[model samples]
Target: MRRGAKRLLLGLAAALLLSATAAAGYGWMVYRQAERAAARMYEPLAPAEPPLAYAAIPQPTRVIEAGGGLGTAGSGQSESAGRAAEPVSGPFAFASEARAQPSPEEGDPFTVLMMGVDERAHDRGRSDTMIVLGVNPARGSMLMFNIPRDTRTELVGRGTLDKINHAYAFGGVEMAVRTVERFVGERIDYYVKVNMEGFAELIDLLGGVRVDNPFAFDFEGYHYAAGEIELTGEAALMYARMRWDDPRGDLGRNARQRELLQRLLQRLVSLETLGRTGELLDAAGDHVRTNLTFASMRGLALDYGARLRDVQTTELAGRGRTIDGIWYYEVTREERDRVRRLLADQLR
Candidate 1:
């Protein structure tokens, strides 16, 4: 895999890890209510306060700027670069418009934009992985949609056609959120951002996670075989980073990432994490960033806890093409509309 692509995929795993944290923690709360003895034993493990929420996450503007790269994905295919129009350059500034916010009521649906970024040397890199998760408590379901990192769209605040991932590079979380809102035609009620390094460390903090590799391959000096495997934080970072050897390319890599996240989440909610509560909180404090407040998270957990049993995952469908010597994923308007309708129904 290209170095740039690897960077993005590694960062992507970090975002997924954080999602698992929320799901697992929420699940514990639900379990506590059903089992008094179990709750008593694990009560001390719960955080005294909710995780911190950041209104403005740090976004460094300086670093060695790197060119964009492309990778294979389940729904999108990469093509060689070709002659194309030049993209506009500048900081993005989008005006806020009136949109529906998340309701405190348990049944109301809310949307969260989860971003994993490859920031190096304090320079904020592009959001390598962008997934919009819609949790619908009323419907007892969750919808997860992956937007290819190379997706080409009107960068909402910047008014230029570029990779959707670039929004974070241009304007941090705010721009990324606006660009996605335009793409999906839905108001994002919250956002979560995770740095790659911190995410890697968090994995190590949990000892390690078990993943079933569908194919055997080597990445970053770590040899992996097809079958069930254990990955330390560092090894897991490489595991999520490698996609070049996979026949499915980006798509196959994404599947493994999802698998790891699912398994890691299951591990998080188990009684085992209770023993490492202090270390877990310390890791989260250093690595994770979110806009969701304690009250909101509690509401989501208590109200939507049982509803989380059903989850549906989907990826944006697009064809990759090179323009102006740059690779871009071109998605159709109809596809955008379809996603919009699906989310609208869920939100309603």
Candidate 2:
């Protein structure tokens, strides 16, 4: 063979190899992007999370001896305050008590209560905020709506409504879950409750999130415009709570809140955060609490590889009404019905 022909052949071989490598790299990038998106969509229970009646809760519900079950009793009370022996149903305040009789539907789709509590050193303050999320894979939609804390009605355990958030503080986790179930007339398959402390940390971990301000406003010395900007966790938290600056008040905060959640999911599933899975999980485990076990979370997380679509958020309407000289957000019958129907459609 001629020397020129040999050189030409070698050049052709190199070009072909480079083309193959480039194609593979592009494909890998696409796969990774999709994988992250799916992970974000999976609001799964943790491996430690048990069904409503199964797992143990965090607090020592009642004091007892070694080898004694929850119902067992000694000098049932905490050592310090001598707080009357808590009913022997919870430690972590598992949803067990709420599941004395389980929901009619066993999460064929899935139901979750996204709760944010105000926690101080010595006291687990009330569930200051509550957002219920009902997701249906079949319908490919999600429903989220809020229940104001002060709205009085029938409480779950005591069957009297004082403040919705008080349920958790009064009876712990199980009580809060049950109270929500009774209020919505829906069974809660799982819950994720976290304190606001780690909110800022998670945002910084995900490289911050982007949000749009409908109108420009000054908040806590930070000015937000009606455009996109990267937000730190503290900024985002502050943004979500800035109802005073927003003309629309809580409704505006609610919109921003949902926007924050959606973007967080998107960023969570992006390639930028792939190598940081352990860190993300650690942040979540420390900040967020849920009954979903490791096994359940894995299974749910695996399901993320399937589809990427915009999540659906329900728009809830209610009037702030005062009863007995106190104020509460009261959902009208029509609005309540609409939420139920929307939830059912998504769950189906």
Candidate 3:
């Protein structure tokens, strides 16, 4: 009623509004800062080889070895160790069968299928590179064992035995995932497949990866001197793709793949990657795919990095052989059993 009284009331209201506005702005700032902190603390997770990228469908025929005896599965173990021993449940049972969610919320291993495809830009190709990785953050260890793309195995969702890589070619990621699951007798939780183009960008992003020159001679204007050398993106691609020049053939190529991976790992771990977070996420979003939620990767990178401060490298034991005019890597039963146990324990 009084003009002076009305003016006083308006002043009080303005003070309250300003206080609330200040509080809200402060809260928003805190949230953004926290997200950035988490992002900065992370290292790129072990790259998911694209083998698991296409698990959305089922294969027509899948490899199932009856009584070949996969693992020495013991009782009273974790689900990962358990999944390592069971048979693939096929596409119909995917979500229910493959528990892609991380239960521990922290320090649980992020399992991914790593696929290296033999195709170039303007060409779509299936993965010729196949490897199963079981990374246990709890154990602070990363383990990868390759599956010979030509391993003689039955393909699930299909009619008969075919080269393992054929599963991806015929059915894409879904068939590829199913085929790998049957071979190792383990449930693949996720995948990140990168081809020649993506590989080149990634190598360049990291400013290049340093690899051990296990072979000599030149290819495509590059000479890989024996021992250790730093490789740029194009050079790294040529370097990683060279197998014919090596004494071991595909075996040498396989070794080179592992080396390329190791160089990435070493580079990722050695740097302060906070500034590159945007570029990193862009690379993963464009070149990588999986059942993994962004939250899941963020959790694993921070949680696992905290627990496992170290990583070790390994390869599968197999002989290169030709079957029906196709080259295949034949892994003996003993090798399967050993890798199974090793991976299971780390994953646990």
Candidate 4:
């Protein structure tokens, strides 16, 4: 062969080899990204107990032991106090009684109360988005439950009947988790509180995500057509935030939020996302807060990751009513029981 032809053949062979190598290692790359993301994303629970003994306080209706079940008993704060203080920054004066729950393990189906808060300056923010994700590793399946923000329920610790999202505004993650647990009649294994503004940065970090828009409408200056569109972080935030124009109102908004989240999860674990690990970590650091530790994250990646591929989402069925001139979503007792049984069966 001529020298030029031989050189061209060599280059082609090299390109093919590189392509094969990348294809073979794509899954491994994604796994590593998950591992790394999980590590940065592990934000442990640090309850702000006002120098009170854990034993002296009345245990929450559902008790979940924290710190790997060793339990923090006395007055020693974590060295990373600044970081620990961020998630629970709400007026927790009356929230001293709330405690963390035990971390779930492999084969143990666990529930997580996901709070997506629209925090404002100096305010802990209302949990505009509330979701319950049930992970059953043994069964290899995932379940999602959307709790309407306006749902009127007894605030677990505050002991007031208010909007379900008020728990977060009143007492932060601990109160939110406890309130949701009591409301659902199940112990929440974990909680992931996300700052809505920061979450937009996260969505942007993932280079945005694609979702099927159910209806075409203009929301907060962002326009959507009746079809699939790739949403930027800001646009995605708007996509999840709008509800007034929808005929179904909050219910319609909730459906869109769930769809966006489901798509976001799928994108997070993709090979494309693996390439943006640094951006992902940056977004996680600024926006996300969770009680999942490094060890438990590893377990999640190893045991539950595969099962999460096929997710089943359920919306808490309820009716809207005005109480004392304020709107509330009144979920029927029968509906709550049905959901409870469904989750229980999945966990089993």
Better of 2 and 4 by TM-score: 4
Using all chains and alpha carbons, the TM-scores for the candidates as numbered come to 0.71, 0.67, 0.67, 0.71
Tens-place lDDT per residue, model 2, 234-281, is: 666667767666777666666666666556555544557655554554
* Better by TM-score, candidate 2 or 1: 1
Q: Write the per-residue lDDT of candidate 3 for residues 1-348, one digit (tens) a residue.
A: 111111111111111111212222235553344344334333343423323222222112222234763432122222221132222333222221333455434666656676655454555566676767777766677776667566756576784555787887777777777777656656676665544335455446556667778657798788889888987766766665566677877666666666555545544544344444344444544444444443554455444444444555566676554333445455555565577567666666
Candidate 1 ranges beyond 4 A from true positions = 1-100, 120-122
By summed lDDT, the worst window of 10 consecutive residues in model 3 runs over: 1-10
155, model 1: CA deviation in Å? 0.8
Q: Candidate 2, which segments miss by more than 4 Å at Cα?
A: 1-107, 305-308
lDDT of 3: 0.51
Order of quality (lDDT): 1, 4, 2, 3
What is the TM-score (0 to 1) of candidate 1? Answer: 0.71
Per-model C-alpha RMSD: 10.7, 17.8, 18.0, 16.8
Better of 1 and 3 by TM-score: 1
Residue by residue across 1-348, what tens digits does model 4's lDDT show? 111111111111111111222222356664455445555556665553232111011111221245544333111222121221111112212221232343444466777777666666887767766788777767778787788878877676776667888888898887787777667756677777656554545556667778898889997787998899998767776766676888888778777766766676565545675566544544554555666764565555445554566678788887665444566676755687678677766665
Full-model lDDT for every candidate? 0.59, 0.52, 0.51, 0.58
Error of 4 at 165 (Å): 0.9
Q: lDDT by residue for model 1 over 77-168, one digit each (tens)?
A: 22323323334332222121233456734466788777777677778877887778777878877676778778877775577777888899
Model 4 scores worst on lDDT over the 10 consecutive residues at 1-10
**Model 1, CA-based lDDT:** 0.59
